[model samples]
Target: MRRHQLAIVVKEKEYTRRIADYIRGSSFGDRWQVSAFTHPDACKQFVKQGYGIDLIAAETDLLRELQPELSHIPAIALVARLGEADGQFELLQFQALPLLLQGITDQFEGLCRKPVKGLAPNTNGKGALVLTVHSASGGVGKTTLALHLAGVASARGLRMLYLNLEKWNTSGLWLQPGGDAGWEGEGLSELLYAIKSGSSSHTSWLAQHRKFHPQLKCDYLYGFRNQEDRATLLPADAAGMVDSIVKSGCYDGVIVDMDDGMDELHYELLMRADRNLWIVSEERSALAKQSQMLHYGRQKYGETFGRIAACSEVVLSGINSELGNPLPAVEAALAPIALPLVREWRRGELHPVWSSSLYRAAVDRLCAYLLGESEESRIHAVG
Candidate 1:
């Protein structure tokens, strides 16, 4: 067993007392060194001294007021409630999980196991796969598919980065660990600017300055949580920026989500992608939108535009199509566009069922697509 030192910072004394008492009684406290902090400045100073605090726990409000820069320390926020958050602190809300210390313990375990160095190549890492999920229509489950694919790829030991390109992002809201949520104030907008005008150091900066997960093998760089943050990426030179980022070799796969329609930025990301997935409902308009999106991609990137797959085209509620019937129409519309249907993302939460082999098989297929492996390769056991 490895020993880790942690810094627990909180504004409310009562909450801190409960958490610390639980820590002292738990088996984890016996294995790791622990310290506590009541002031944000104190924790900031400790981080500045290069003494790495393996984990940080604090309240959502405290984190928002003082967004300190401790690049390596993965911070967790203890929240009393859950809802929409506003401002730069939105990133911090992810850090705000439920007040349960057990979830905190689980998070701690995962952080310790994460790879602390640069990513190494695997089947999924050999060549970068940029899969962007977007719908011209909302409630189409684009983010759900993106998260499931990322999780499946990661569980199979691939190095992946999921980037939310939409300026007004909501993926972070659902993906928060232990119900903790918060924005880290960086995204494609920052990375794009840094890559073009900034020095080579920017690449290393993005890599080393990421939050880690103990349960999965993926690192996420989140987008703006509000419309304002999305505005920061405005007036971008999409083609030049995409080309530079794609060639940088900083990540093995870059999954992005841009708004629907044939905007400059949307086409820019689609053309650069090695695998582009367009998600839509089975409704007439959704099917039409899928057609338009595919045609738009071909127009922008030419005939060899990355592989295309239509997800949730017919499964969504309110569509008149019978179950599994829309697959034919979807395939038909995509034929002329040159994008083919690879798989369907079944609706609802994507957690794998332990008893069902069919669900497991679907996950394996997703992993195959993500790893770029042939049909013959065996699926790696999920850790």
Candidate 2:
């Protein structure tokens, strides 16, 4: 099936270009085909020529003029502000491009009531369980924990995928060996483009592009090769990419190594995750930072913070007998699971820890907490 087509009729070329770019980078781009026109007459002519346009967005005056001709199609009127008396037209602020695009898609979907074509059907009926490992402070062994979790799950015969969403791609340093042949094809950027373009064969592209981390014992997707690539991605784009990967049914679970931040992208992924782990060190400064982050989240996100807080488990990494218990305030705010520090980890050697008794025990306990079963019992069942 073909995607729904959208027409943008605005007098400003800059607005048209910006809107086009936004749509191309968003999930809407995958679900809908878009064309921009600087004049309403051009849009009207295109429609009159029997081109299929499921939705139209134009400036207030132009939309009022095009309404009589394109009345059957849903239309959104772009406005500078919300003081318009015309309740018949959907009014959207031009400054809020993301919101405006989302509103347009929602209006079109509601009015058309038609399913989009060329999208892969959910044949598996069940998606991968998403688990995000995050920290408010960096260098707290968050990525190490995430890798160990994926490795353990894979060792238990579960298909797993690890996604490193940090600003820089550093998993290669630990997971890939020195003599191994490095990645050859496109990385995450290409896959995101294929998804945004609504390609039906995106699963094939993902399979071709995914890198295998032999030590981690799972398939992994590297982060953007360039810092500029990170800047161009929006929360919605990440959401779309994750959704497509999960829907592919190529893995039983996905472990995300999230960057240390409270940005929209991080929040979106955290909210969508089936389980979330917040890793923090035993240091006073780390706990203080975590507390401040929690406060900021509550003040900014309000009710959304409640949902995030409910699903999250705080893990205290780098804990030793010498450190004793955490501060009363920290304990009250977060009852963290204690994780012992592995000596080899500090030396930048992780493969040996997979078999080390102490390291395995800690990870097994953490896994049991996440999977809601005794480590032995779960491993036996899975194996």
Candidate 3:
């Protein structure tokens, strides 16, 4: 990995110190050099002098002021607080992607953003890995798969994240009930508001809590809580947030849980994901939904959709047939219909107490697959 410096741009001395301290105090500072700027003007001067910066942690207004001179800099908003009134997601929508792309574009202007500095030629490999998990039909267990994949990767000691892109499922299942134990009103909704409003001390405000599972490694950013919040993360904004995380270099792999229903946001994510999983179930409805989704994907992406590199079918909650127990009278009723490669999961096989473990295994397989490994290839591996 190429060493990249973090340039902190803020006007106040105290604020600059706080930002510096935040970096020095975190895992990033231990390895990367972090510098502070008390004024936007000074930071721009540093950039003009060809003192390159790989990342910037700054305020939104402060960032805008430096945009012209620091146009080439990669940045992430250092949100100050966590509250619903802040419009955190909205802020992420506007700033994240443009800033990262700006940095990349600046670095590779001669090559048209190609060969991004410190990356392999012809390879957009910025050491950033993004994975998307989606099912055309609900109840096929995409969330379960996403959650478990994060756990397994984390267990293998890889820095990873699980992001749910649907408000209802994200809040109801992943963030609300499951993520609230250690955190206080902090979920995707709260995170979005925090960043947008530019409060203070927001690090802990965005992390999701979970029961321990050794195999999966990750953090999480849940989807919107309702139309109100979703409205904040418009298509452009979602793209920006994703770019921020990718440029942050804080994660090795980002697993996004896409909604089953087709939408502009979903389509946008499908374009960004390095690996896309099209999960389907044996149910006829699921098959119908998958067919429609596949049609849309192929139509929109052309041949690229076929060459997406990683695409698979995951059959979940299917029937269990014991050996020599006589097959079900109707084979069609008992088996998953013409499933592609499969990961069979049955509630009956898992103990209630091992729900977390079961979840971890599924996610582990997912991470392994994303990193270009087969399930039988390794007991444990980290990207």
Q: Which stretches of candidate 2 lie above 4 Å from their native place?
A: 1-125, 179-184, 327-336, 347-356, 379-383
lDDT of 3 by residue, 286-331 (tens): 7667667767776776776665423344444332233222222221
Instruction: Note the clash tally of each candidate.
Output: 20, 1, 26
The TM-score values for the models, in the order shown, are: 0.51, 0.62, 0.53
**Candidate 1: what lDDT?**
0.51
Poorest lDDT segment (10 consecutive residues) of candidate 2: 114-123
Question: What are the Cα lDDT values of the candidates?
Answer: 0.51, 0.69, 0.52
Candidate 3 residue spans exceeding 4 A from truth = 1-123, 170-186, 190-217, 222-227, 300-369, 374-383
Comparing candidate 1 with candidate 3, which one achieves the higher TM-score? 3
Q: What TM-score would candidate 3 get against the native? A: 0.53
- For candidate 1, the per-residue lDDT at 192 reads 63
Find the number of clashing residue pairs for candidate 1: 20
The digit string of per-residue lDDT tens for model 2 on 1-383 reads: 56878888888888888877888888777877888888778888898898988888778888888878788887766666443425434445445776566556544543444322211222234566678888889999787788788888777766678887777657766666562223344777777776677665444445445667676578887566556766777888787777767765456678888889797988888887777888888788888888888888888899988888887778888887676765445522353346787666677554442545676568767776555565457551110
